[model samples]
Target: MSLEKIKTVTLADVSINNKGEYGIGASAVDYSDELYTYLRITDINDDGTLNKNDLKSVDDVDAKNYLLNENDVVFARTGNSTGKAYYYDKMDGELVYAGFLIKFSLDSSKINPKFMKYYVLSKDYKGWVNSMCTGSTRPNINAKMYGNMELILPPREQQDFLVNILGEIDNKIEINKMINKNLEKTLITIFNSWFINFENYDNSKGMKIDDSYGEIPVDWSVEMLEDYVDFVTGVEPGSKNYHEKPEPNDIPFLRVGDLGSRDNGVFIDPSLSKNKILKYDDIVLSLDATIGIVKMGLEGAYSTGMRKLVIKNDNINQPFLYCLVKSNRIQRIIETFATGTTILHAGKSIKHMNFVLSDKKTMDDFGKIGNPIISIILTNLKEIEYLTNLRDTLLPKLMSGEIDVSEVNCDLELKYNYMKYLFNQIHTPMSKSVV
Candidate 1:
C-alpha cells in the first residue's frame, strides 16, 4: 500500500447528502426523566469521546427532527471547541444533538466514519481549524468550510483494519473504566456498611443509644471535622496572569471541573502564586457549584473551589478519611451547609459540622483492609491513563499512515504486557500510612 496510491477527497464527496445536507441541531432543553438524550458541544470531550454522564435530555417530540443515527458524525461549530467532533454510534435510546453541533451524514462505503472521526480529532484538524476559523471574540467554522476540508482515503479494507485496531483499544479502555467504577462502588459500599451503618463490624443487636444526630456506635465519639483534619483552600490567579500553555516546571492546576475524570487536567505555571499544592493520594474536596465532590488523583496546585484535607492525627487513616468525606451522608451534610445560589460551601459551617470519629485502632485496622483495595483502584487508574495515552498517540499516526498496523504488533496480550511494564515503572507509590 503506497501513500501515492491512496485517494484524497473533500468531505463533500463522501457524504451521501447533497453539499448543504449537513444540519445544525436543535437547542438543548432541560433534562426530563423520560426524554431523548441531548448532546451539546460541551458533551463531546476534547478527545473525541462522548461525556456520557453529563448528558441533558429533551422531549422526543422536540428532538424528532434532530434524532441521531449510527455513522453520523457531529462537529462543534463554534467557540473554543470549534473543531471537536464525536462519532455517534447506535444507542438503545433516541439521541438528539444540540444547536452548537453540526451533523455530518456520511456515505460509509467511500469513507469509514470511525476513521474520519479520528482524523477530525487529530492535531492536523486543529491546525486546519486555527487557519480557517474566524472571529473576534470566539472562533467559528461553518458547514461550507467543513465540507471543503479534505481527507485521505485508503482502500476500504485498510480503513476497516485501522478502525478495528483502534476500536479494540477503545473498547479495552472503556472496560477498564467500568472495572474502576465498580471497584470504587464496592469500596464505598463496604465503608458505608462498616462505619456508617455499623452493620458489617457488629450487630450491636441489643445495645442502642440516642444521640443528637441519630443512633450511636457506643464506642465511637462525634467531633468537629476540624478536629480530625486540617484543610487549606487554593487561590485562583486571574485569567490575565494564568498560563494556559505550561512550560517546564509547570504544575497541573486542579479545579472542581477536573474532578469529573481521573486524567482530564491541565498544567499551569507553578511560580505564579502561594497557593497550596497537592500530591498524589492527597484528599481534595470540591467546595463550589457541586459541593463535597472528592478526588485524590494528580499532583498540582488546586483551584479556589477545592480544598486539600490533611488528617490531623496520624492514626486517623487518610484512605478511610477519604471514604468518610465522600460518603453520601457526609456529602448531604455538606450540602446542608452550602449557601448562596451559586453553590458556595461555607468554611465556618464545615469547621463546625459534627463528624463521627472512630477509635484510632479501629480506623487503623480498617485502613489495613481498605488501603489494599484503594491501591488496586489506583493501579487500575494508572493502567487506564496509559491505555488512553497509547490510543491517542496511535490514532493520528494510524490515520495519517505514519505508522502501518502491519508493522505494529496489535496482539492484545503483547500490548497489555508492554503497558503493564510501563505502568509499573512510572506509577507513583501509594502512601503506606495516613497522610
Candidate 2:
C-alpha cells in the first residue's frame, strides 16, 4: 500500500465545528475547596492521557467555556506544547480547558480518534508541528495552522482495526493504572489506620495516645520508625563528575526529579556506570524539592542526591516498605518533619519518627495481599514497556511500508483479557470512583 493511498487528513476534516475564533479569555476567580476539572499542559501525560490531579476550578464563567467531555480530544494549540494532544476519559462534571488548549471532536467514520491521537502524539508529527509553530516570545500554533496540518488515514475498517488493537493495549494500560491507584490508596489507608491514627491498644511505652479518631484494631502496636527501618541521605555527585555519555547497556542513573507515579518507582537512565549503583530493592525517596515521594530501584545505579532508605531487616518486604513510605500517612509525617524556606526539606534524622507496627503474621498477610497485586502491576508495567518497544519498532517500518499492516494480526482480545484479569484482581468490588 502506498503512503499516498492513506490520504492526508487534518483536524478540520474530522471535527464537526471548527470554530477557530473561540478563545478562553483571562478571567480572575476565587479558588475554592470544590475542585473543578481543569486541563493544563501538565495534565497531558507523555503517554497521551490526562492526569486528574492537574484539575483546578475557578468561580468564573469564562473559565467554564473550555469544558470537556469523556471523548473530547484536547489539542495544546499554543505554548511549549503547541501540537500535543490528549483524550479525556472517565472525567466527571464540567472540565474547562486552559487558554492554551483547543477543543475538537473526532469524526469516527473517516478517522478513529485514538489513531489520530496516536498520530498527533508521534515524534515525527510533533517535530513537524514544532517546526511550523510561530511566535517569538511564546511559541504558539493557531487553529488555522492546526487545520492545515496533514494526517495519514487508512480505510475506516483498517482504521478501526488498528484503533481496536491499540485501544486494547491502552485499555489494559488504564486498567493497570487503576489497580496501581487502588493499591496505593489501600496502602495509604492501611498506613493511616495503623500509623497516623494509631489504631489498636496500649501506648504506655513512653509514647502519647490518641483514640479520638475511631475504633482500634486488635494486635497492633505503636513504636518509633527508627525501630523498623534505617534512613540514609543520598550524596550528591557534582554535575562535573557526572558523565553524559555511556554504552547503550550501561546502568540507568535515576535522579530525584525523574520519579514518576506511573511505575511506582524510578526508571534508571542507561547512561551511568555500574560502579555508581544503588543496590537492588533499595527504596528511592525523593527528599529534595518533592519530599516523601518513594520508589524502589530495580537493579541499577542511581544518583546520590535522591535519598535511599535501606530496609534494615531481611524479613521486611521491601516492596511493601516502599509502598508504605510513599503512602499519604508517611508523606504527612515527612511533611511535618520537613524544615526549610522555599523548598520543603525532609530532615536527615528520620530515625526519630514513629509508626504503629503490626505483628509479623499481619505484616506477612498484608504482604501476601499486596504481592499478587504488585506482581500484576509489575507485569502490566513490563507489558507496557514491551508494547512501547514494539510500537517504536513497528512505527517506522509500517510508515515506510517495510512491514505491511495486512500481515500483522490485530486480534487484541486475548491480550486484552490477560491484561484485564490483572486489573480485575485489584479492582474487585470496584467503586465508581475514578482513580
**RMSD after CA superposition, every candidate:** 4.7, 7.1
C-alpha local distance difference test of each model: 0.70, 0.58
Model 1 residue runs over 4 Å out of place are 18-33, 91-93, 154-158, 201-212, 235-246, 261-275, 339-349, 360-362, 407-435
Tens digit of per-residue lDDT, candidate 1, span 9-106 = 98888876735233434555677767777877777777777777667886546576887887788888888778888788774356787777777888
Pick out the ten consecutive residues of candidate 1 with the lowest summed lDDT: 426-435
lDDT, model 2:
0.58
Task: For candidate 1, list the clashing residue pairs, or say none.
Answer: none
Give per-residue lDDT, candidate 1, residue 386. Answer: 60
Candidate 1 local lDDT, residue 88 = 83
Q: How far off is model 2, as Cα RMSD? A: 7.1
Give all TM-scores, in the order shown.
0.82, 0.74
